[model samples]
Target: MTTYTLNVVIDNKQLLLLKENCYTLCIAKKVRDQLGDKYNVVWKGTADFTQNNQFKWAEQYEVFALKSFKIGALVEAASKKEPIGHKQECIFNDSGVMEHAKADPNLGDDTFKVTNQYGATSFGISTILNGEHNTSYISPVIIKGHVVFAPVNDIRVWFALKLPTGTMFSDFTGEYVELQFGGDKTTVTVCYDDLGSWKLKDSNPGVVG
Candidate 1:
C-alpha cells in the first residue's frame, strides 16, 4: 500500500495531513497558539477527495484543522535528518497546503526533485512515497512540476486565498469542471484561476476576499 503525508500550516505553525481511518464529519479546530505549536491541524469535516473541500458557513468563519508546529524546531529536525518529506511529488507551499507534482515519465521516476540542496535537488519523493506499480495517472506536466491533487475521486480544490496571515480564508476547497496547466518559455501555471482566482504564494498570500 502506498502511504502519503500532507503538510498544512495554521496560525504560523506547521502540521502534517493524513487520511482518516475513522471519524466521518466531526472536524477539529485548534487554537494554534495554545496547542504548543507542534501539531498538525487536520480538518475533521473535510469533504471527500471527490468533492470540493469548500463549505459555506459564514465565508471566513468556517472551522478547520488547526495543527501547529514550531517552525524553528521543524527546520532543525529536518536538517538533522534526511528530511521529512523530500519524496513523492507532494509538496507543501507557504499555505501549508500540499500540491501533487509529476515529471515526464520518459525522464524516469528519480528525474524530478525539489529545490536544490547543497547545489543539488534531492531525488525521489515521488518514487519513495508512490511505490504503487499497479497504475499511473501521468497527465501532461513538465519539468518535474506541480499540479493540484485531489483524492482519485475528490474534485476538492482551494477556491480563494485562505488568508494573509492565517491558514484558511472565506474561500475553501471547492469543486470545478476541469483543472489544467501549461508552460512555454516564461510561465508555468496551474490555471486554477479560470475556476476562481488566487495570488502567487511567493508574491502574496492575499488579504481581502
Candidate 2:
C-alpha cells in the first residue's frame, strides 16, 4: 500500500503537518473540508510498483492541484515566446476534442481520427518546476523533491507529470495524453487538463481524476 505525508499550507507557509504515513484521498478530502477554502493541502508519497516490476529503477512523480485558473495562468506565464525549434511526439486521445465538438455545433464532425502531435517545442511550466532540466531527477530526495498539491475546495484543475523514463499511475477517468520514453525501463508521463469533468474511481484513494 502507498501512503503519503500530508501538509497544510497557507500563504506559502505550512500550517499543519500530518507525517504518520497514513494519509490517503479520503483523509485528505476530510481535512480539506475541515480547513475550508483558505488553505492548501499537499501530500508527498511514492506509488506502488506495478505487478510487472521487472526493472528495479527508482522514479519520481509529482502532482499539483491548484486553485481556479491558476494552472492556465502558470502555463501562459511560463510558455516561451518563441518556439524551441524542435518538437516532441505526444499521444493524446480524441475524447477531449470530441467533447468540445459536441458542445459547439460550429466545430463540425465530432468523428475524426486523433493523431500524435510532435509540435511541443517549449517545456512551459515544466521549466519552472523542474529547473534547467526539462525532466525530473532520478531518486530525488523525498522531502525536497517529491511533493503534491491537493485542491482547495472546488478547485479542479490538476498538473501531473513525471520525468523521462519514469512510469506514472493515475486513476483519472478522463481524456488524457502520454509522452513515452523507451529504454531498458520503459516509462511514460500522463497529462490531464481538467479533473472536474472526469470521474475518479471511488474505490481507490489518492487517485486523481
Candidate 3:
C-alpha cells in the first residue's frame, strides 16, 4: 500500500510518500494531480478491478479517504525526475511478478518529482513506479441492477454500475441519462431504464443528481 501525507503550507500543499519504494505513491500522486481538486483523498488504499475487466489498469483502485480540500490551500508543484535502486523492482500487477522481471528492462534511470508551492523547498523527492497497468479502455459492460427515486428537483435519481465512459442521456424522451468518466473510477453511471426516471443506486461524490 502506498502511504503519503498531504501537508498544506500557507497557500501550497506537499504530498509525501512515506514508504521503502516510492513507485505506488508517485503513481497515485500523478493520478490525483490529473484529478485536480474535484475528489478528496485522505489515505488511498489498493484499488481492485480484479474481475470481469481483465486488464489490471482498468481494474486498478486507489484506496484513499475523501476530503473536499479547500481551494485556498492549493499550490503549484515543481516537476523533475530522479533515479531509484537497480535491485529494486517495479511490478505492474499485485500478483507474483518477480520471475517475469528476472532481467531488468532498464526502464532507465530517473522518475518525476513535485514540490509544494510553499516557501519550503524541501518537498522535492525522487520516486519510481515499477509496472503500470495499461489503461486504454475500461469495459462499458452492461449492468444488471435496479434504481431508486430521489426527491424531485434533486439531480440524483438512481445509480447503476457497468456504465461506459462518456455516455449521454436526454430529457427529450422525458428523462435521459449520461455517463461521464464521473471520476477516477467512474463510481456511478446515472441512467434510466424501462422503469420510471432512475439513477445509479449510488450517487457520485459531490453530485446530488
Task: Show model 3 residue runs off by greater than 4 Å.
Answer: 1-31, 38-191, 195-198, 202-209
* Native RMSD of candidate 1 (Å): 19.2
Q: Please, what are the lDDT tens digits per residue for candidate 3 over residues 1-209?
A: 32211211111111121122221110111221221211111111222221111111122221111111222122122222222232222222223111121224432222111212222222211122123411111111111121010101111122222222112222112232332332243334332323434334444432322
lDDT per model vs. reference:
0.22, 0.19, 0.21
Per-residue alpha-carbon lDDT of candidate 1 for residues 26-114, written as tens digits (9 for 90 to 100): 12122111112111212222323222122211101111111222221111112211222212333433453333443434333222323
lDDT string, candidate 2, 1-209, tens digits: 11222221111111111112221211111111112322111121122222111111121222111112221122222122221111111122222111111122222221111121222122110111112211111111112211121122121222233211112222232322211122331322222113212232222223333
TM-scores of all candidate predictions against the true structure: 0.17, 0.15, 0.17
Q: What is the lDDT of residue 75 in candidate 2?
A: 21
Q: Which has the higher lDDT value, candidate number 1 or candidate number 3?
A: 1
lDDT of 1: 0.22
Order candidates by lDDT, high to low. 1, 3, 2
Backbone clashes, each candidate: 19, 0, 23
Candidate 2 displacement at residue 112 in angstroms: 55
